[model samples]
Structure formats: C-alpha cells, structure tokens
Target: MASENQIVVLDGATARTGTGCMHGISWFVAKLGSTLAGLAADLDASLPSTLMTSIQAVADQHRATCDLLHPGTPSAVVALLRLNETVLEYLVLGDVTVIIDTADGLQVVADDRVDRTARAEREEADRYPFGSAEKQAALLRMKHAELAARNTPGGYWVAAADPTAARYAITGKIPLDTIRRVAVLTDGAARLVALFKLMDWPDVLELLDQHGPTELIRRVRAFEAADPSCMRWARNKRSDDATAVYAV
Candidate 1:
C-alpha cells in the first residue's frame, strides 16, 4: 500500500495448521497494513509508535474470538518508508528487506534474527532430501525450535498479537535529497540475491532500474521453476509469496 508520502509493504507469514486465529494470514496483514498506513498519514507520531498502535488495533479486533497467545498466530514482516520535505524515514521488522539508493551508495536494512535462531535445526533440515520423511521431521524440529524462540528477548520478533514487537524494528532517517530510489522486497522476491546468490544488491537495483520490479520477480520465479525439487536452493518451500515495490 502506497500513498503520496508513505509506502507500506507487508509480507504475511504463511499460516500454520493451527494459527489460533479465525482469520487467515492475508486478513491479518491487510488489517495491519491498512491500519499502519492510516496512522502513518498523520505524520505526528514516529513510525514505530504508529506501527505499535496499528498492531494493538488489529489485536483488539481479533482478541475476542481468537487465542491471541498462540505461538502460531498470524503475523507478518513489514517494510515501511515515509517521505517528507526534509527526510525519508524507514522501518523494517522481520525479514523484509528495504534497500535505499542514496548518493553514497545503496543501503540495505533487514532483520535476520529469525535466521540466527534455530540454526542447528534449520541446518539439519537442509541436509536431507526435500520430499523425504527425514526432511519433514527435521523441518518440524526447526519449526518447534523457532516457535520456542519467537518474540522472546533473545528470540526474533514479528508483528503479531504483541504490539511491543514494533519497538524492535530497525529504523532510521536519511536526508531526502540523498536518496535516488528505494526498493522494498519480501524475502521471496529477494531470493535471487539473498538465497540464490544470482546477483549483488547493486545488481538488483540496476535490474530494477532497467527492467522494473516485475522483471526482478520474474527472475526469481524462473530460478524457482528451474530448481523445483529444491536440490539447488534447499528451501523450505518450492516457491514463496514474492512481492516487490519500487519507489523513486
């Protein structure tokens, strides 16, 4: 979601078997994203505060019917950019990548605490064949480990029922004049550079410059199609939800 002064990108977490919420991930993200956008438009509050309020608002809506304390409750990674006359402010929560093309160079911000946690389990899962029962078991272990660490002080945080998680988001402001362009990508769309190593960040911005965001996502899909069995990529999912937004 984008407005003249603000851009909000949310990648909803895939729903687990029991998310504890009556609504789906799509509904969670939509509600959170729209609420964030509306609050951001006011511009009086900081991005983190706005996000916190938005999260609480969403939680309130579902608190009556849902088990908000469930570990697998719906959540999302967020990337938000707000532009004004003097500065461009950004907030990144979870794995969403926000790349800024500035006069100095490209600046990339991503929260990788999730990757750092459950390392042994994830590595074990990666060692087995994609479709084998061994892989499934390893993957389950990884998920359990991740759940144990989720939203704790030493663990990773995401936008879920807890509004305080917004305070952990990476945030900064840059002089608006120094920025040339900006690209926000969900981890899926960023697989080309992050997971596949097909290109560098500069290459990614260059590709966005020449071919546009669609082309970047197309390349990711092409790579996923080539490695359908995950033999080369060794990913949990053969394909993920890919989303990219470019602003200049």
Candidate 2:
C-alpha cells in the first residue's frame, strides 16, 4: 500500500517445503510498514537509526502471532521509501528494489547478494530440462546454498523473524527535489529488468510513466505466459507473485 508520500512493497517468500501459514510474512510486512510510517513523521531521527527499532517491533509482532523464531518460519523481502519536500529516504531489505527518478536519470537500488551466492547452481540447473531430475537436483543445491547464506555475516539479509537483519538493510537519503518519482518493487515484479532483461531501468521508468505499475506487471506476466516452462528465462518459478508501488 502507498502511504502519504511513501511507497512500500512486500513479497512473501515462497515456502521452501510444506505449505504452512505464510501469513507471518504478510503480518510482519504490515506491521513494518506501519512502524516505518509512524517513524517517518519525525524527521529528527535518520532512517537508518530508526531501522532497528522498527524491525524489532515487527519481530515482536511476528513472535506474538506465529510463535516462531528466526530462520524457522517464512520470511519476506521489503522495499520502503519516503519522499518529502526536503529529502527522499529509502531502505531495501532482501532482494526487493527501489527505482528512483532522479533529475539526471533513473537510479536503481537493489540487494543482490543472495543472487551472487546461487549463480553457479542456477546455471547448472538451467543446463538440464525444466522437469528433469538433474534440474531438480541442481535447484535443490542452489536452495540449500541460499538458505545457508541468509542473515549471516558476508551473506545476504532479509526481514525474517530476525531483528538483527535491520543492520543489513541498505538505506540512505537523497535530495527530494532531485527525485521526480519512485517505485518500490518486490523481486517478483522486478524480474522484468533483473532476471529477464526485458528492459533497462530507463525503459521501466518510461513504462511506469506511460501505463503505470499495473501495466508493468501485466507486461511481465505476458512474457511469462508465452514462456510457461521458463525455457527462455530459466527461473525457479514459471510465474512468481508480483507487487509494485509507485509514488509521484
């Protein structure tokens, strides 16, 4: 949901194994969004400084609702942004991304450390057919490596049940007047540019300016529909859940 001049995008992680209640991720995201909104009202504290407290509040809510600890339950990546008259503040956790429309051009901010760790396995999986046993084995290997790297030093971080992950978030502030607009996107919606290379960031900005966020998602889904087996894309899911928020 878009708040005031803020854009928040949250995507629930695909369950690794059994189908349990992934409600925790949504709950965490909602609480986190609210916390950040509340914190944004006070410009006295920097975004990075307030991050830990915001994360802890969400973690506490998660524990109270799901009764699960870090690395135990499902998690989600988050992309949050606030644009005021003076400054544009942004925070990115996990693989979600923020695209800012700057006076010079479009600037993209994304956390891809998770992708760096799984490249080899992803390539190996792509070597075999989609449903082949070899492909499955390779994918499994990739998933294991990714899991091991999560929330650790030298590894990627996400907004899991872990409060400490707040420290891993990428955050900063830019001159508000320099930014024309901003888009907060989950990995699912960002596949068009990141995974598929269907368009560059500038092209994405053009799309957003013309048709809006829904058009961008529709374009990605259309591409996926044409390549249902992911034959051309070589992805984990044929179609992933996607979400985006645009603030102008």
TM-score of each: 0.97, 0.86
lDDT of 2 by residue, 60-173 (tens): 654554645534366677776776569888888888888888898778899888888877887887777666778778878877777778888988887666667878789888
Candidate that would win on lDDT: 1
TM-score of 1: 0.97
* Residue 169 CA displacement from its true place in model 1, Å: 0.5
Q: What lDDT is obtained when candidate 1 is compared to the true structure?
A: 0.90
| lDDT by residue (tens digit), candidate 1, 48-129 | 9999999999999999999999988999989889986699999999999999999998899989999999999988988887
Ten consecutive residues with minimal summed lDDT in candidate 2?
16-25
lDDT of 2 at 159: 68
Instruction: Estimate candidate 2's RMSD in Å.
Output: 2.6
Best-matching candidate per TM-score: 1
